[model samples]
Target: MSPVRRQHVILRVVAKLLIPYILLFALYVQFHGDYGPGGGFQAGVIFGAAFVLYGLIFGLERAKAAAPPRIIEILVSLGVLLFAGVGVASMFKGGNFLDYGVLEHDPLAGQHLGILVIELGVGITVTAAMITLYFYFAGRGRA
Candidate 1:
């Protein structure tokens, strides 16, 4: 991956500037997904992408410092848990699993929020899993 990426101070600076906002936007996308085309899954990918690029340039250790393995693993589980937990919560609130209506005082709005949160969860988990997998095998079979 590092070999594939062209290294330049400008690109690194650009990436550094963009990464935080990208992650922040991912959060916005995750939370506001009900009314938009974005969702947690997409947000996760976008979020993970920043670090992936970072790793490609600076090496895995720096990337890990940005997002530690333990934290990433937890985030991976947390996102899934959040999605599933919402589903279960909805079930108890007289709706089917993942039904958003039970999420708030207003069922319609609740649905929107619920979907956003769940999608964000999916994104986080997926992104973390992908990065983790990449790193896990990144060092293997490389000359």
Candidate 2:
């Protein structure tokens, strides 16, 4: 192993322990955002932080391996599509743009569903964008 890796054994171990919990908390925040004090953007940042922590400790190359740039790019586009698609779907369903009330047989259920999906799209986009930025900036000025 390289000297740097050998020197950061403690950091690597701690990161391993913390990363899972961070991801779990992200999920909790994501699903619970509608009812409580959390949401897609927050969860996305937290999710991105886990990978950022991994990169800081393990090296950028390893982090990229864990989450490739291509996949992250795809997710960014996909997330936007998902979000916009929801709005378009609502239009098709005979409602105004993003009219969640038209999303289901019942307005309440449709509201729940629309919010959930929209939040998910936001989370995915933010997470991917964060990772992409990290990869771009980190890869710069490197040999």
Candidate 3:
């Protein structure tokens, strides 16, 4: 254990308790985004914040172990691909790019599905990007 972890036992315990709830809240914000005020961006930030908090309380190495940089990079690309894939799929369905109306037999269902998928992509991208940024900045002075 590092000096910070050893010194801040209470903080570590508190963080352990809060991190799960934070992640859960992020999920709620993500799924409920379309009908409510929150959305992918908000959920992504919240999710990233949980990992950041874990990094702060525990240590950067441990956090990195939990969420590897390579995986994060892959997620960033995967999210963009997923977003664009949806648009392309819509086009293949005989609609304009990102035209969710043609995604399904029922236009309303297509719209719902499109929004859900795109928002999920946004959330993944944002979450991964945020963690990558944190890793970059936090690890900068170390090596």
Candidate 4:
């Protein structure tokens, strides 16, 4: 009815349309890192940016509801575990820590798999951390 309400509707429509594309691009960066210059770090930042944009367009409460703090913490821990688990697995495979050559029957495949897993871990951690930071800062001084 009001101008503010109309603007809100438009904003919501635009965000809903854009979020999927943003997340898809992030995935591309994550999976295509081996061939290109982008990697987990870049992908994570892009993924996190999508959430941050959602928060900016919607509200902090909605963002928190979408990604709870507990889930974020768990993702952070799991990312670390995933990264470290690769190293541990290599050790058990009779290779030095982070030695990807032992991850599979073929050394090249092993290295590729190892890099993918580690990059995934990195992406998870960075994405969670960035979202968590935004939640905390946005919620600061609130009742």
Q: Order of all candidates by TM-score, from best down to worst?
A: 3, 2, 4, 1
Report residue 112 deviation for candidate 3 (angstroms).
0.4
Encode model 4's per-residue lDDT on 1-143: one tens digit a residue: 33454478878899999999999999999999999988889999999999999887887778888988899989988988999999999999999999999999999999999999999999999999999899889889674
RMSD values for the candidates in order, in angstroms, are 3.4, 1.1, 0.8, 2.3
Q: Per-residue lDDT for 51-100 in model 2, tens only?
A: 99998898888999999889999999998899999999999999999999
Best by TM-score: 3
Better of 2 and 4 by TM-score: 2
Q: Judging by lDDT, tell me the better candidate of 3 and 4.
A: 3
lDDT of each: 0.79, 0.94, 0.95, 0.92
lDDT ranking from best candidate downward: 3, 2, 4, 1
Q: Model 4, residue 80: what's the lDDT? A: 86
lDDT of 1 by residue, 1-143 (tens): 35545457787788888878987887787666767777767777777777787787777778878788888889889988988998998999889988899889998889777876777678879889878876777645452
Model 2: per-residue Cα lDDT at residue 72: 95
Return model 1's CA RMSD, one decimal: 3.4
Question: How far does residue 105 in candidate 3 sit from its true spot (Å)?
Answer: 0.9
Candidate 2 vs. true structure, TM-score? 0.96
Which digits, one per residue and each the tens of the lDDT, describe model 3 over residues 1-143? 57757899899999999999999999999999988888889999999999999998899999999999999999999889999999999999999999999999999999999999999999999999999999999999897
Error of 3 at 44 (Å): 0.4
TM-score pick, better of 3 and 4: 3
Q: Which 10 residues in a row give candidate 1 its minimum summed lDDT?
A: 1-10
